[model samples]
Target: MRSPFVQLLTARRFAPLFVTQFLGAFNDNLLKASLGIFVTYRLAEQSGLGASSLVMLAGGLFITPFFLFSGASGTLADRTDKATIARWVKLAEIGIMGLGAWGLWQQSIPLLLAALFGLGTHSTVFGPIKYALLPQHLGADELVAGNALIEAGTFLAILLGTILGGSVVLFDRGALVVGGVGVGCAIAGWITSRQIPPAPASVGPDAPRPRLLRDSLDVVQYVTSQSKLLLPALAVSWFWLFGATVVSGLPVLAKDVLFANEQVVTLMLALFAIGVGVGSILAERLLHGEVSARHVPLGGCVMAFCAVDLYLGSLGRPRATELAGAATFLREPGSWRILADLVGLAAGGGLFTVPLYAILQHESEPSHRARVIAANNIINALAMTVAAVVAAALLARGMTMGELLGLCGVATIPVIVITAWIVRRGLMKGVVRLVLRVLYRVEVDGLEHVRAALPHAVIAAN
Candidate 1:
């Protein structure tokens, strides 16, 4: 008797959480996009660091915190009321933005990098709470829709932030503009954070907390012990690894290999981001708010295929003399192929990621949910770092971007194959069936009991 959209919206727990999460993502991306642009133009020019070095430094600053703090962050989420944590995290974001504003005023590369690290730390701390709290707030039936909306909102934020950052950087007072916007976004995010209803702690407040190192090790041990959780987490980590490698290499590829300009690179990024956003939203419908773990295998295959095709497409790179403006880049015969590949890769990425995330959220124990997510963030950060190193190595070795991408695609194949094998194992199937049966019982209690009892009685009579 309820409209579908209304039903989704009227769900008490989800509504506030969705708004809170969306704003958080929006703010994060807004700040990150502005910072990325600021680094690209102002920092590199003023600090005497080459553009590449500046970019890499910025990336490193943002990623390092995840490696260092995600585990601790996860534990905190498990130990606290998530709504309280979300509020404090938002407040922390405001302080981080203030530091960013200071960096902008001084144009101090070190300060900016430090602020970036602080921001990353804040994000890392929030990671586990963000994901872990969802299952607490929403029923299993709502998870897919909730996650899809989150993914869509996050991507939309990224797109908006990137566009805003790009526009602001062209201004004479770009730094001031970016700083003001970041501060404003942080404030808005904080305000939204207040609306999130309290989520009860999963563990006892008086439970003895482990030391940091041991706590992190425990998170890893716990997650790895559950195959349903472990496989998806590993698969998600690999997606980030593959993506980081490609995206980090894209600038170099665009300039050195594709012989294209900055605008082209930006456009390609936009295309990929948009594709991912669209694909993520579509996953909601495809998954129907249930366990659609098979999407991971399917997405992995598509990703490998598209990556290989992109590599092949790049084999006949146009000469430097053939370089063109953004308009011409779009109109060129070969450009369409590249664009298609980018879109496909982006779509595949969305398909690959959303399900894994849903599975992680769905399978994790509520108390340790945040810690599990923190582990995911840690792995993602590590994978990205490795990707950067590998990309640099490939570049140093004089491998063309296309060739490097091809190699990455080839590398992904083995990972995907292994994931598929794991997913197909009897143990995994048994676990999945058990989870599904439990969920089904929860959904249709009397009917499930009747079916089970009737089947048992029939077997006894036989």
Candidate 2:
């Protein structure tokens, strides 16, 4: 069989879709990161709110739309041709970026908040379309590779965006520069979307587009009806939730616990993102184009273990001066341990997430795929909201970032245990049986092929 990477490249439909998805992710993060930095540094001076509070507010403004609009967006994706939806979504991004540009020019916090909300809305509307479009464009066998590439692209984009955002804020006219870059990225994403092949609507012409609440209920009902789909979808949602907690808490952890500056914080984030990207792409290679649904439980186990390790890594606070350059940070005894923990956490996150996404796409019905993705987005937003509230509360209660990390680590154990139990109950026997059957079949094929190559050889069908 051809290699997974080769197979992925050979597929006519995948390259354009990959580019479209990657650029979309890149632009989304570029804008979000730039806006986040602006709120944290520039807007705080005008609004009189502390940087942390403003950052939290910016996060809320960005995520709230997912909760409010994902259902509608999902339904829209199902009802329309995905290519058309993608085009429209990219157009919407351009308009949203325009608002962001205006906000940046005015240096208005209110305007920025409004622009953020608009961006959030744009993302919410695109969520279902993005996920649902994949099944239409790719074969079942390509799902894993597709998801891996998408994940890799996403994390890499995040790394670049975070770097750019932080770097821009140090410049004299940072907002304008960042805003211009964000606009350009959005436009580039739109150009990529235009190259995507036409994907016909999976939903019927007569498919009922219900009211928002009704549509959400129907989508939930539809998703839950398929056990394989529901479980993985929930797992994917949880992954995002966990990710949100870690990412949102990083600045606090770096500054308060490690006594680090922004550069150090950025380094930690970049390392984590790079680790995740590596792991995600590696999964595709390891799986070799096969459905590796069985890996999900293993990934969960690793995630739980690494989360606890991260807590342990955070136990002892570093000395104030230790948090300097990357070289110095790496040379420190404790820093190596922390870096190891971060890598473990990121790798486990990739393993846990990439498979779940592949599973969700593989198992969900095409007709309702977008709605299911919308549901996933809704849950992700809810999880992020909860994480924000909880993190804020913990911080307010005089808990250090290290202690909060410990609590999250402790909490992850039960979560992983429960999820593993559920997955095992559903998938274990079937997977074991399939493995045994494949082994037996492989041996039989080997013997038959050997006989077939010999002179006057007889082949056995059995």
User: Which candidate number has the best lDDT?
Assistant: 1
Tell me the tens digit of each residue's lDDT in model 2 across 325-411.
666656656877777777777777787788778777777777777888988777677776777788878789898777776666666
The TM-score leader among the candidates is 2
**lDDT, candidate 1, 17-122, per-residue tens:** 6666665565566566666777777778877778778867787778877777777778878778888988998898888888887787777777777877887877
Q: Give the TM-score (vs. native) of candidate 1.
A: 0.86
Q: Clashes in model 1: which pairs? A: none
Clashes of each: 0, 0
> Residue 341, candidate 2: how far off, in angstroms?
1.5
